[model samples]
Each structure stands twice: as structure tokens, then as C-alpha cells.
Target: MTNEQANCDTMVADPVVGDGCRRYVLPRQRPGDSTGDAPRVAELKCKVAELESQLRDLRRTNDTLKMHVAKALGLQLDSPIPGAGFETTRGGKAANAVAVSRRTAPGAVRGVETQVPKPTETPTGVEFRVLGPVEAAVAGRRIDLGAPKQRAVLALLVSQVGQPVSVDVLLEELWDGSPPPSAITSLHAYVANLRRALEPNRAPRKPASVLRTRGRAYLLDSRMVQVDVHRFGDRAMAGWQALDRGDPQRALREFDAGLALWRGQAYAEVADTTHVAPEVVRLEELRLWAIEGRCATLIAMGAHEIAVSELAAFTQAHPLREYGCELFSLALYRAGRQADALAMLRAHQKRMAEELGIDPSPALQHLEREILHQAPSLG
Candidate 1:
């Protein structure tokens, strides 16, 4: 068999990632070749399209079934209890009623299928966004979060949603460990105002739902609220997992979706407080990792020129970061700028040694060697 036929045969059988060692290029079709690979690839493409359509349909059907199940389970909650003046409405109260029945009248829902989502499940009610400013939106409508201190409190709880925050911790964060005689009272007042803003429709004298009290501590319930920080984390993790699985296309898609959630600096209203500072820095670092991963996946998918354009500003923004330098060098090498790639690495090495008094990392040094030889594995 000719070389073109061998290339065509390999391209048809191997995935685009191809064992993570080499690029998988489809050869041009030759005249009068009996291999018939042109039509074979088209046939495989058609099959893939058909399978993808079927998968989408399956997902839609599954979603429809889940909705039907939710409706069926909620039907019992919608009915008024005997001699009890519960409103026959469909909302938080209905969901609460299910919990009540399970606890008080266990036998009633003993055999019933429960669909009450756990606290970790993302809710459709209130979404707290700390990726940008501390903001809350209830069903697409943004609410007024009272004062700066109150927003800082929310930001602290949002950074650690579903966990209890002690009153002492709250006071320290709010007042910087210098509490006035009226400090506790003022904190109570702030929490009251926050509850009013967040759960405006919460009935009077009923325990505060969204932001709840636990002895001397308070917690923002994840079950009742959705957070963009959590969403970004999930998407970023998924993207990394996809990249590890040699699916750069899916990785890029996930990274794009995740990074789009960031509007500005994390916890912008309360950037460097005692409680919020660590989380703010950690989130920013995660954002950087996701961005770097995105560029790596782009280069892995043979879009090295696009990666080069992206990493140019990233390297400028974070020149001392060895991983970013390594990625930029690899992207340059893959984009066919072999000389430029070596120069970029050497420049980074100089900056490291001059400014930080340290040599480049072993990985970066190895990458410089790889680019010098135009290693086939750079692809």
C-alpha cells in the first residue's frame, strides 16, 4: 500500500487525539485509489451525527421523565392537610410540607418516591454570585443587598456555602476584631436586614430560611440557593477531566462555559477581608488554571496559533508563572515558530534568574530542549 493509503487508513481508525503523542492528519484523496477512504470518512461522519442525535434525544426524554416524576411527587404536597390550614400552593411551602410529612408522618410517604433535591443541588430560587461583586438574584431579578458590611457577610458565607459560620467569626470579619459594645446588636441588625432583603416573601415569625441560625452560628443554605462560584468550579473540574480523557473539544467547550461566568474579581465588594481574602485569592488562582488549561487544550487540538494569540497577554499578565511560560513556548513551537519558542523560554529563564534568583523549572527546561529539536511529541 502507498503512504497516502496508510495515512488515510490510520486517520479513519484513530481518534484525533491519537495516543497523545502525535498529530492525526487526514491525507488528501488520491486519484483512482481503490481504498475508498473518502467515502469511508463521510460514512463514519454520518454515523457519528446519527449517534449524537440519538444521544440528544435520549437526554431530552430523560429530562421529560424527571419533570413528570417531580410533578407526580409534588402532587401530594399540593393537597391541603386534614384540619390543617396549610396553603394549597406550589412553592417552598410545598417542598417544606414534604419534609414535614417525612419527619412527622413517616408512614404516609414510606413507599413514596422522594425527589426533594439535596442541599448541594443547584436551586432555581436565589443565586448568589461572588465571581463578580456580591450579588443575589431571585428568579432572574437581582435584589438589593443592604450595606457594605452586610454584603461582606454574604460574601463570606457564599465562599463557604452550606457550612456554619460562628458569630465570633462573623464579628471578627465584620469589625476587624475591634468590636464595640453594640457590636452583637449591630450584627443582629445587619443579619435581620439581609434576611429581609434575601427572603422578602418569607412569612413573619417563621425561622429564616435562606440564611438560617444554628445556635451561635449562621449558615447560608446551599439547598435554597445557587451560586456561580460553585457552577464555575463544577465546569472547570469537568473541563479538566475531559482534557485528561483526551477530548480537547469537550474540554474547550467546558472551559469556555465555565470562564464565561466570571464578570470581575471574585468577591469584589469584599476583596481582602480576614475571612474573604483567602477565598478570593484561591478563586482567582483557579480561574488562571482554567484559562491555562483552555489554551493547552486549544494547542492540543491543533489550534496553536489561536493559543499563541491567547497566551501572549496571559504571559504578559503573569510572566513569572513557569507553567504559563511553558504553555506559551509549546504553543509557539506547535504554531511553527521554532526559533521564537526557544527565545521565549530563554527570556523567561532570564527573568526568573534575574528577578527571583532562580533557574527555570525542570519542566520548562525540558520543554526548551524539546522545541530545540522540533520533537514530534510537541504536537
Candidate 2:
């Protein structure tokens, strides 16, 4: 067929410019066109469908293998894994022409949007864990959290987690009350660097859905990211509730899971910084509480031997905390070491009186009385 008849079939559609020739696009069938084209188009469509199925399968297999590798190596990376960047480039015009050729024939071109619509982004599972050193992982790959100051900023944001932190507070904590005039500008740069690392695949100029701008404040979107500190809190709270509801087995599992997630001290890298100090202190306390709760749960399950072993060390390490001492003594008593238990409580009382010139809480005192009287409920 001639170039003029090109518009008649599903073929080339090139509009010639600066010429007097006018192209009329007839959704017209080519003179020799018949029923054969339908079968050809259907076959091509089936091939595309088959290719899509294969692509999905390959992706799943890739994910499973990466997961296994990540687990086997015990990787605790603090940086984004390289070589996983998505191909955001769209199909070329020729590829679009191919698609049009295979289906309905090309029609007279009116106008098309010049900008190619980018592919929808895949949701990345980015996990930031500050339970130990501040680190992050995306899709089983480590993400470098940048320099110390940047990591500190991340810790501050993670401390507030789902809440917005104003620019002033971040600045105050960053420079420790003596910020340079360029502190705000520097802070923005740090955030930009962090966003790049955290979202390596995020489109340019797109608003960050994870680390977001909220007026004058910036908030980490809690829904889009996972924070190990938050996860631990959730598990610990669930464990406590389970214990209260008389489900020691489930409680033990939850407590153990939360405890296992701790890599080291909370905010270890930035522990000295003002922004992280309070959070470090608070998480450390919560960890201790979780330990005591687990120990208490064990005792309730009549595992006095285990409770004695754990609480003895816990109490010895934190002697000033009467509750640990109380639990230790109780566990000793239940383990049939009545004299040892009484001596332990008496020693604590004597030490408090002599060292601090203060008395133990009433709970400890009451425990002593109950032990001395051999209260039936103590069983």
C-alpha cells in the first residue's frame, strides 16, 4: 500500500509537517484486510500474558533467595544495598508504536502528552532499628545511615516516631544549644542525604512519603516504615497484657521476641547526644522492665529455679532497684531456699539503711512479712 494508505491499516502513522499534504486518518480497513488479523493479534496478546506471568515468578524467586541470603549471613547493615535500583525509564516511542501495531491499527494522531508517565513506585519495606546502633535496612539490604550527625537526627526523629518534630527542637539538640548560623541549612542537607539513602528508588522531585515535610516540622511516616524500637514496645506491651490475662505461654513468646530484637544498648552510637540520651535511658528502663516481667512470668509458671538464676543477676546488677531485689528474694523462697531468701531480703534492708539511710518500698517490706509468716498465698 502507498504511504497515503498507511492510515488505512494498523501501520506506520507519521504526520509530515511543513508540507501541504493533509493526512486523513480513516479507521478504514486496508483493501486486502480480512479475518486473519484477528488471530494474529490474539496470539501476540497471549505471548505478552505469558511473559508477564514469568516476570512475576522470577520476582518471587528473587525475593525468596535474597531473604535466605540475608538470614544466613546475619547481616546487620547500616546502608542501602547497591545494584537494586529500579529501571524508571519508560518505553521508547518505537516500542509504543509496536504495541499499537499489534492491536488496533494506528489511527490519525491528534496529540499525545509529551511527558512519559513514570511507573508507579513499588513500596519498599524500609526498617529502621535504633534498639542498638541506629541502622536501617531496605528489602533485606543494608542502608548506610550517613554521618554521625545525620544518624543522630534520625534517632531524634525515631524517638518521636510518628509525631512531627519542629525545626527548632532538632536544631537545638543537633548543635547542643550553640548552633552555627548555617545550622538550618546543614540540617536540610543531612535530611536530604538520609532521604536519598533511605529511598534510593524514590523518584526525583517527589515528596518523600516516608520522611515527610509537615509545615515547619518533619515527621517520619510511621505507616510506611518499621522502627524496631516501636516494634519492641508493641511486643512488650502485648506480652504484659497476655501475662495479665493469664496466658504465660504467649506472653513468654512475645517477651522473648522483643528481647531478642535488641542488638545492644538503645541508641548506642548516639547515646551521649542530648537528643538520644532520654530515649536511651527510657528504652533501657523498658528493657529491664520486660526482663523482670518475663522473670515474674516464669515464677508464676512454677519455674522457680530459672527465675532465681535470672533475678539474682538482675538484682545484683541493679541493687538500688527494690523491685528486682524483691523478685529475687521471692524466687529464692519459692525454690525452697527459705533461709537464703530471708537472708537476702535482710541483707538488702541492712544495706539500704547503712548505705543510703532510706527504707525499702512497702512492697518489699510486705514481702518480708509474708515470708516470715509463711503466708499460704505465698505459694
The prediction achieving the highest lDDT against the true structure is 1
The parts of candidate 1 lying over 4 Å away from their true place are 1-124
Lowest lDDT block of 10, candidate 1: 98-107
The Cα error of candidate 1 at residue 84, in Å, is 64
State the lDDT of candidate 1 residue by residue for 187-241, as single tens digits.
8998899888888788899888889998999998778888887678667767766
lDDT of 2 by residue, 139-178 (tens): 8698888888898888888777678888998998889888
Candidate 2 Cα misplacement greater than 4 A, ranges:
1-123
True-vs-predicted CA distance for residue 259, candidate 1, Å: 0.8
TM-score of each: 0.67, 0.64
The prediction achieving the highest TM-score against the true structure is 1
What is the Å distance of residue 66 in model 1 from its true position?
A: 40
